[model samples]
Target: MPATLPRLSVGETVRVAVGVLAPMLAQGVIIRRPGVVSLADSLDTNRHACRILGDLRERYGAGPVLLRLPVRELAVVLDPDDVATLLDGSPRPFTPANREKVTALRHFEPMGVLISGEERRALRRPWNEDVLDHRESLHRLHDHIVAVVAEELEGLLPSDAPVLTWDRFTPVFWRIVRRVVLGDAARDDEAITDLMVALRAQANWAFLRPRSTRRLRELGRRLRTYVADADPQSIAGVVARTPGVPGTAELGQIPQWLFAFDAAGIATYRALALLTGHPAAMAEVRQEDLPTHRGLRPLARATVLESLRLWPTTLTILRDGVEETHWSGGTAAPGTGFAIISTFFHRDRSRLPWADEFEPAIWDDGRAEISRALVPFSAGPAQCPGRTLVLDVTSELLAGIVSQFDVAAAPPVRIRSERAMPRTLAHNRLRFHLARRAAG
Candidate 1:
């Protein structure tokens, strides 16, 4: 019904299929592999596709790449101008409800504020607009996490045992997440997390195993029910009191903030790894005399921002074209799904002056261009409301971790997932060798 970008080469399609799309389909949610869907695992698939797309863009002049499959169709738009059109608020009201999110998030948040269009947007705004007003509570939250990290770091390394970050920090980060999400009643949080673990295992085994969405839904239900009865002042409480939302009755909906916990954990730890890896940066962070909240000047904020750019958790966010529209030299009819890829714009030479380099100073001055380009939390009306909370928490975590341990890559360590971006660094392939820092 609309114009198409240059068709993907046969070789490139296969590469895109295998590298960028298969891994996601192989997860528990995808019962039958669709003809076309492209979500890349940074290390395994996205790297290859990024290389291919980069070449294709240079050849085709920076528009979009249409991944053609008989049963499905996905258009990967790389141009920043086009991306802005997709993400920023528009009258047409594009929807973000996609299969992948339905599979993963429905269990936790049936329709949390993450979806698109005006109704959902209105649903999300009230809470997001006010999430930051509770800064005093966030300070307490930071103190709680820092205390956890301080205590957890002690027993993790086994006296002088060498540790890879992926191995050592993963559990620690999850524990902190549990505490944050579950609050005072985190004593039995592992049993709850076990449900998520099993669900993900099924997601990865979607290809071989008979799936059970009912069970996963039940698991999420249980976790929420558990949290509902926990501390009254938790993040869930904040979600409950918010003016407009899906209502706090569904604990699953409120803890949607924790859904990004994996990404947040990896990013925060990566900040530590990055800072430790870059001595000048580490020295800059060490010199942060300002309180952690006020942007944690120079290095801390830079490391968090830079690390996110390098290995963002939100690699690609999609929107379904609700009506026929023009975008990035092409046309989209209703139901056409387009992706706003962070790496494409963040690393694009046109939008970002830094492109693929780590310069904390980009964040140091609060550059408007960088704000427009780097979309780890997304932008415009769809932009995450929890930006301040996340940044503050992440900065504090980075500041807190580095304050205690000198985190660095631990060589010769066996790890989990090897990913393109930095988010998966803690999975398996890489690790950090941390040496405790003595007090001044």
Candidate 2:
């Protein structure tokens, strides 16, 4: 018979909640709250979480350590193989549409593929993949996206202001997002993004707070209008073209794309931070002929991947077991929720020699591919469908930025390459100094 899974003591559970779970909530699981983010950064929340989870792993010995939460069976996965199992058996033995996720995402994307039932997921997933060009690194709308990046990023380095703060860069980033996802017509549609922000803020509360029906409806109506226009160059246009049954939630999926782009924006900024610190990596980025390179630039893509590895935007990857499952430690009953704290694996020093360093070569080399734990976009069947498209857009944006200006992190946000990278990078507080390159 298989051994029973170890259960965390009540006190241990509370510590896990405070040390690991609470930080994720505080950091804003849905839309990041600025004040809380500043606090979290000062506190270095992720590092605390790593220590808490690491101690638990040492005690439990590669746990799916059961937490003592009321009215729910939950476990925190520690082993890399189990992480693989949980992700690989997605929407089956383990479903991505777990309770907390459903409760949260319902606020912004009620019918998104992430929280959909099998039938609806089957339809929506393929539609998302097709539209996003899931299999290809360079999206079908690659040229348009590159053009959007080039245009929006043009004035970022003005002669009067060489400083690039988050405030300075955010609007430019959003304009690119709007144009890519909703077309050039919606480039200035701050109203739609505002609606999304409001709803996602509600989502951060999950089931504790009441749903903002009025805001959600308004967001839906606005998204539908964009879909109706179906500008051929945008993802919304692809959604409009894709045929679906009544409940496919065609418009529903679009919100997630927009939402995911918000995290992508954070990652993009963090990538700039990483490049700012590591002159060697930035030098490699500068070497690439970005203007003529049509496909994803290898160095630029790897740098973005490294940024994600160092500080993953998605705090936790949660899944629920749909049926009874046996693990090396023991068996988990059906409906058992599993939490994968990605930072633990990504920065686990024992397994990864370069865990805490700014290393992009791991991605290009065979190292990152061998590890199941380095899931920047997740793995297996339930992995993000838009991974390729996101990488394409972000890498292009990074390449575009570096091609024009020399970047260095501004005061109060220091990234020293000689030292180990910080566990949590506060993208909001991040600022850069950009100087225009002399014409050759």
Candidate 3:
């Protein structure tokens, strides 16, 4: 018979709650809270959480440690193999639609693939994959996206301004988002994004807060308008053109794309910080004949991946067991929620040799692929469908920025290569000083 799953002591449970769970919630599970981000960065919350998880692992021996919270049972996965097991068994024994996730996402994307039932997921997932170009490194709309990037970026880089702050970068970033997902016509549609932001703010509260149906309806109407327009050059167009089944929730899925792109923006900004801090890596990116480089842009893509590894935007990856599943330790009953504290796996010194460093080459050398634990975009059937699109857009955006300017980290945000990378990077506080590149 299998052994019973190890249980965390009450005190240890409290430490996990405060050190691990609290920060994720405070940082905003759905939409980021800028103020909380600043605080988390100052406190180095990821570092603290990693330390706590490490201690738990050492004591419990790679536990899916059972935590008996007041409401339900949660297993904190510690081992890489178990992480693989959880992710690989997705939508069957394990489902991404955990209670907390459903509670939060329902406010904005009630019929989204992430939280959908098995029947609904079958239809929605395929539609999402096809429209997103899941198998392709460069999307079908790659040229259009590249053109959008080049056009939007031209406005971002001004001769007079030597510095770029997050505040200054955001509006331009959203314009790119609007153009890419909706259409060129939606480029100035800030009100649609505002409604999303408002709904997401409520999502962060999850079960604690009530859903705002009025605002959700408003956001839906706006998205449907863009979809109906079917610009033929945007993701909305692809969605509009694609044939859908009865329960596909086509409109519902688009919000998830918009929500996800917001995180991609954070990752992109953080990647800029990583490049500014690491001159060697930046130099490698500069070596690429970026003007003519068309395909994957491997080095630039790796930089974005490294940025994601260092500071995972998803924070906590949750899965719920739909049926009884036996593990090395014991069997988890149906409806058990499993939480993977992503930072612990991404930065654990004992397991990953370069955990604390910014090493983009790991991605190119196949090290990142070999590691089941380094899930920047997650793994298995339920992994993010937008992974490729996000990477393609971000890498292209990076190439565009570096090709035009000599980038450096502005004051208050210092990323030094000699030292270990910070456990938390506050993208909100990050700024880049860009000097115009000399004519060839």
The most accurate candidate by TM-score is 3
TM-score of each model, paired residue for residue? 0.80, 0.97, 0.97
Residue pairs that clash (backbone atoms under 3 angstroms), model 3? none
Go through the candidates in order and give each one's C-alpha lDDT.
0.58, 0.88, 0.89
- Measured by lDDT, the strongest candidate is 3
- In candidate 3, residue 370 scores what lDDT? 82
Could you give candidate 1's per-residue lDDT for residues 1-440 as a string of tens digits? Answer: 66755677778778767755554345223121222212222354434545655666677676667777675557777666666677784425566665455445554455566643356656555555464433232433455545555565565466767564455766766676666556656644676666665555455453345556677567666666655575544555554444453442344344456655656766776676666556676766767776654433446766787777766557677776667667555665566667665655666655556655566777658763545657777776666656665666677667766677776666643221232233223233456766778989
Q: State the weakest 10-residue window (summed lDDT) of model 1.
A: 30-39
Clash statistics: count for each candidate: 11, 0, 0
Candidate 1 at 116: error in angstroms?
7.0
Cα RMSD for predicted model 3: 1.4
Q: Residue 224 error for model 3, in Å?
A: 1.1
Worst 10 residues of 2 by lDDT: 287-296
Off by over 4 Å in 1: 1-12, 23-46, 90-92, 116-121, 128-152, 203-227, 240-250, 292-298, 349-353, 366-368, 412-427
TM-score pick, better of 1 and 3: 3
CA displacement after TM-score superposition, residue 384 of candidate 1 (Å) = 2.9
Error of 1 at 34 (Å): 24
